[model samples]
Target: MQAEGGLRERKKRETRAALAEAALRLALEKGPDHVTVEEIAEAADVSVRTFFNYFPHKEHAILGRNPEHLERALERMRTAPPEESPLTTMWFIVHDVLRDLENEGELSRRGELIMGSPNLLYQLMMASFDDERQLTAALAARMGEPESAVRPALIVSTAGAACRVAMELHKNAPGRPVRELVDEGFQLLAQGIDPAFGPNQSNQKGHS
Candidate 1:
């Protein structure tokens, strides 16, 4: 029974991956707005009804892939040694996953495609925000703290900002690992940039 269950789970994962890959390929060839669910289903070699069974909308087919990595990172953070600081654990998990993606050569083309289309970028941002919420909740639970704790929110925002900056940096330095950008961003945070400064020296220096 255990072996059969594992096989079934693996098959389901493969089916979902096929659907997502098909959607992305079609969206790349012909802009995301032009791709239809039926076309995605055909490309994935599944019936349209089967596609709906896996995803509620065509956008879900493309955006759902983001959650898989986020979930895995969250699980890693949750299972890290109890002695690890929350920030350190979260950063470690996120950096490891992003580094692996960088090593796999999966970022350049997808990053360009996502950055080129405002609609797709907006969808991706929404998905990323959802990931932030989930990770925040999981981290709070793991740390035995109230879910409304400010620390979790700060952690999520910091991590999200780091990822956004990393993506922008990747556009210019495609050869550099994203972990470097993330590390640099965290270092800036650690150096005590005044929160009231609005990320500018004028605000920090009280010029206006």
Candidate 2:
């Protein structure tokens, strides 16, 4: 029974992935405004009803929330030894997410499409803010405080800023790993930002 249940869940995940990929590809080929849920469903070899079951709308298919990713990261933080700082734990979580995204060959293409579309960029940023809220809540839970607590809020916000800097710098640089850029951002934060942003820093690293 457990095996069957697992299989069923796996199939559902597969279907969702298929639909998401198809939706993004179509949005890239045709503008997101031009693509319909039916088209995305058909491309993924699923019925329109199935697509609705997976996602309420076409945008959800393209910009889906990754709750499972957050859950796994939180589980890791919960089990981590107390010696690890919250910043380090947060970096591990962020790095895992970047690694997962980098493994997808279509990530670069998706980034390009998002960059080209202002509306998509807005939607993406809003979704990102939502993710940050969720991350802050998890961090607070780990710290045994309310999500509104200043410490967790500041920590998560700083972490989010570091991630943004890393992602922006690494987005178009095909040769540099996102993790390296992320670590560099964190290092800058640790070493006083003014010194790290000096001209020497720019000359020291190969961007592409």
Candidate 3:
């Protein structure tokens, strides 16, 4: 029964991934406005009912945010070792999220899709804001600080920027290992940026 249950869960994940990929591919090819749920279902070789079972709305399928992935990251953060600083915890969580996204291979096309669709752009922006809010709350709780605390907010912003810039750079240079780029970003955060970039330094001191 356990094996059977595991297989069932695996199939569900596969179906969800198929539907998301089909939705994005169709949206990119024919534009999101023109793509219908039925068409997406057909593209993924699933019934409309099955697509509805996986996603409540078509836009969600296109956006392809996996609840399971987010949950796993949250769980990791919640159970993180006492010695691990919030930033290190965030690094692992972000790496896990990136690994999942990289497996789906959607990050590269996401930029083009968002740029072409105004609605999607707005949806993406709102979704990012919500994600950050959730992470901030989680980090604040973990640190025994209020949500308004500046330390948690600052760390979340810095970590979030690292991941976003890494994704953007990876989208442009597909050959570069995204994890390496992300590491470089985090390293700069850990060991302060170039002195020239410091606010107190001369503006004309350097170019990086």
lDDT, candidates in the order shown: 0.78, 0.77, 0.83
Worst 10 residues of 3 by lDDT: 199-208
- Per-structure clash totals for the candidates: 0, 0, 0
Evaluated at residue 151, the lDDT of candidate 2 is: 84
Show model 3 residue runs off by greater than 4 Å: 172-175, 193-208
Q: Alpha-carbon error at 126 in model 1, in Å?
A: 1.7
- Candidate 3, residues 92-111, lDDT tens digits: the string is 98888877877778766865
Worst 10 residues of 2 by lDDT: 60-69
- Residue-level lDDT tens digits of model 1 in 1-208: 9999999978887888789778878988998899999999999999999998888888878644644577688778678898987777767877776765556455666666777778878877887788878888888898787889998878877877887888788788878766777888877766655656555776667965
Q: Rank the candidates by lDDT, best first.
A: 3, 1, 2
Q: Kindly report which residue stretches of model 1 are placed more than 4 angstroms away from their true locations once superposed.
A: 64-67, 99-105, 193-208
80-134 per-residue lDDT for model 2 (tens digits): 6788877888878877777666675655666666666777777877777877687
